[model samples]
Target: MASLKTTLVAATILVAVAGCAKKRPADLPPPPVDNSGPVDQGGATGPTTGAVVPGSDADFRRSVTSNTVRFGLDQYDIDPEARAILDSQSAWLQRYPNVRITIEGHCDERGTREYNLALGDRRANAAKNYLAARGVSPDRMTVISYGKERPEAMGSDDASWAQNRRAVTIVLS
Candidate 1:
């Protein structure tokens, strides 16, 4: 009977320890949003026009030349994907003289607020430099860092962090 009690106690302790050892996974990124409208699919209306967007089936050149390209985590470095997208963006900027864009940088919730802010700025500046190097006027680009304040994804996992660490381009009026 004493042996049975010990065994029971041991099993109970094991269960408790196992329960405590379990880990929680971070939230994941959501499905892509359907960003339709005349403007999103390489087509634009009003004011600006005649910009080309590669890989788009729109009937005509987009009116404005604002294209957003996403990037990887912990990296302010511009990757091949980003470069291809920027190349297309540069073509558009070259076609249109008066268009200007703002690069908004964002980071995940893993770092300190100030650190994230600076990191975000670095990311934005990295993108800005790339655009400038591509022959876009330095005066035509602006950079803003949102750090962790604005999230493209709210998950605590790598997937969410990947989504969060991005530089988005918004057209400036």
Candidate 2:
């Protein structure tokens, strides 16, 4: 009887231990890949597992000439300098047709939130239009206005304001 009771307790403990084993959630997605190194100009990413994955946002940004284009204060027009950058971006977008992107418009801190928001919108649209005209599909692009909420450079000077007045292209997928 004593041996049988010991055997039963051992079985119970084995069952409890089995129940406590770690289980991977079936609904969870795989962990994201790290992409901090310099971009490969070739533009392809992910291993050859037969599973296709979109390129990382950072890689896409580095693959292009510039991820951001500067704009004149209170202006949404694409200047010559901005045009060059946009041209490069357009070419990159053409290469990665499946990659969707968002253009974030930003303005300096000199105007009211409402006014700045409108300016930012115009700025984002101007960039989007430029890329669209350069053969990138409009369907792959979206726009948002940040107004003065996000600034690349913080200061009450011309240099800082110039940095803030810009359009930044962000990869979505």
Candidate 3:
């Protein structure tokens, strides 16, 4: 009778263990295999997930032109319009893996020298942050603060100041 009880207990434990086995998630799909043609990487694998492949010369040029981001003046905040531009830029960057950009920060001549410098930094960083928010790789973007040094419009008025207080996106070759 004791042997029978022991065998039944063991069987129960085995059944419980089998029942507890993990099941695959219902939402997961099978890996996409490209078996129709030759493998991309010499029978290895294509680019990994979230991996950016280099772009061609034409692609780079298109990225440079299409991903240009502009900014507002006296404020380093990313606005809705700027966000829309950045979103397009992010798509362009993703499409052209070989593209990288530098966000140059500038300030108008209204503020003090040091204040302008800091504000320029803030503007540049803000632009980069916007791009990053839109899925552009942080590694592919750089920031530089010109601080009222390089003015697009050389006038000392509000119009020129507004133009000068800008973040220009430059493409890196």
lDDT of 2 at 81: 89
Off by over 4 Å in 3: 1-73
lDDT of 1 by residue, 133-170 (tens): 98989898888888888887778998988888877766
RMSD of 3: 18.0
Candidate with top TM-score is 2
Q: Rate the local accuracy (lDDT) of all candidates.
A: 0.71, 0.82, 0.67
| Deviating ranges (above 4 Å) for candidate 2 | 1-54
Judge candidate 3 at residue 33 and give its lDDT: 23
Compose the digit string of candidate 3's lDDT tens values, residues 1-173: 99999999999999999999999978642222222332232313325652222453234334443333455666888777767766766777787666777777778878788888899889889889877877788998888787876666778887877767767665554
The model with the greater lDDT, 1 or 3, is 1
Cα shift from native, residue 117, model 3 (Å): 1.4
lDDT, model 3, position 1:
100
TM-score of each: 0.63, 0.69, 0.60
- Cα TM-score of candidate 3: 0.60
Per-residue alpha-carbon lDDT of candidate 2 for residues 96-129, written as tens digits (9 for 90 to 100): 8888988888899998999999999999999999
- State residue 150's C-alpha deviation in candidate 2, in Å: 0.7
